[model samples]
Target: MTGSGHRALGLAAAALTVTGAVLVGTGVLPPATPPAPPQAVEASHPSRGRTPETGSRSAAPVLPRSEPRRLDVPRIGVHVPLSRLGLNADGTVQVPPVDRPEQAGWYARGYTPGERGAAVILGHVDGDGRRGVFHDLGRLRRGDTVSVTRADGSVATFVVQSVEQVPKSRFPSQRVYGPLDHAGLRLVTCGGGFDRQTGHYRDNVIVYARLA
Candidate 1:
């Protein structure tokens, strides 16, 4: 999609401060990484005329709106409860409390986990010398599974499509927060070289996944 066609979701300049470092830096988004394999594309895109068996990672049926209760990334050993995150007074997205590094925050104003749009979840990579909920977010590879449990007791399972680490200055806001035809999930956290001067990571690690 053309960049201009997408909504300039306020997340473009969103940032959150952790204990002493910035977790999600301003204007951060996914990297300009190579496109995922064909199978992954099929899964991320709307099913349309294709049948389920056509793609091993075919998108799952969309679910009604509901608050996410938990997030699980079995491969990375992440099983944490989700907290509702909203915009800060200045319009940037809010982050989980610095003391609660084990919890991840879901963008409450965005699409729900099982909805036919990108649902964003944010966490810190590390804070106060402790590992954050998404410390291993960079380890997720294509075809991996990430699931979110909703308040309705249903789980929205997604197959990982790509993992990228990009500098905050080059954050692709359109691709990250833009509208999607199928259910998608985005897990984001700080990564790359840490700038001791600014107390923030130089890059953002973004994991893109599609419902399955």
Candidate 2:
């Protein structure tokens, strides 16, 4: 996908449960850097995390991690390993080639949930008939809960604030990519129903949630 394609794409962190890689070989993405492996922390229920609905780390954390170890959704009782990468210098998300799509995940060197700006998480909808980690991202609703386990053994929780379906032709880049100035989370994935022709959904579904 081109820069235009990326802007039209939705990469809601929560929506990652049903997302995938974009803009390969665009030279627009940044150089890939492996994570130094975040300190491991025990798992905790989203409720047991920092303050609810307004914790200090409630916003998205963009700290470097060994990798995105796990992704948890309280509302849907969904927990899965997160594998993927953020945009490079260009507007592309590095991911496995379509042949080995399931192997794709986040680069793990970008951000963590509940940091500064919006913590973005991405994934594939389906690969080889096997649903991707975020295959069911669209099921998320307002007031739902999403959790990410950081390497420093700290866990941040976020509460769903809103879900929007935007046409790929006009994605809310600044609103989504701009600095949050507060802890936040972005769950991105393809939606508005899948489009077989383009091999992607026509609209990007972004679920905006705040650190709770």
Candidate 2 lDDT (Cα, whole model)? 0.50
For model 1 the TM-score comes to 0.76
lDDT of 1 by residue, 49-120 (tens): 221222443445788888899999999899989998877776567788766667798878788998877788
Best of the candidates, TM-score: 1
Candidate lDDT values, in order:
0.68, 0.50
What lDDT is reached at residue 71 by model 1?
94
* Candidate 1 positional error at 59, Å: 7.5
The reply for model 1, stretches above 4 Å from the true place, is 1-8, 11-21, 24-60
* TM-score to native of every candidate shown: 0.76, 0.62
Q: Candidate 2, residues 1-212: lDDT per residue as tens digits?
A: 23542342344322332233241111121222111111211111122422113435433344433334677886655676666565444434555444443343543333456666556665544454444444456667667888877667766777886665555565555455545556667765554545444545555555677867
Q: Alpha carbon lDDT of residue 78, candidate 2? A: 63
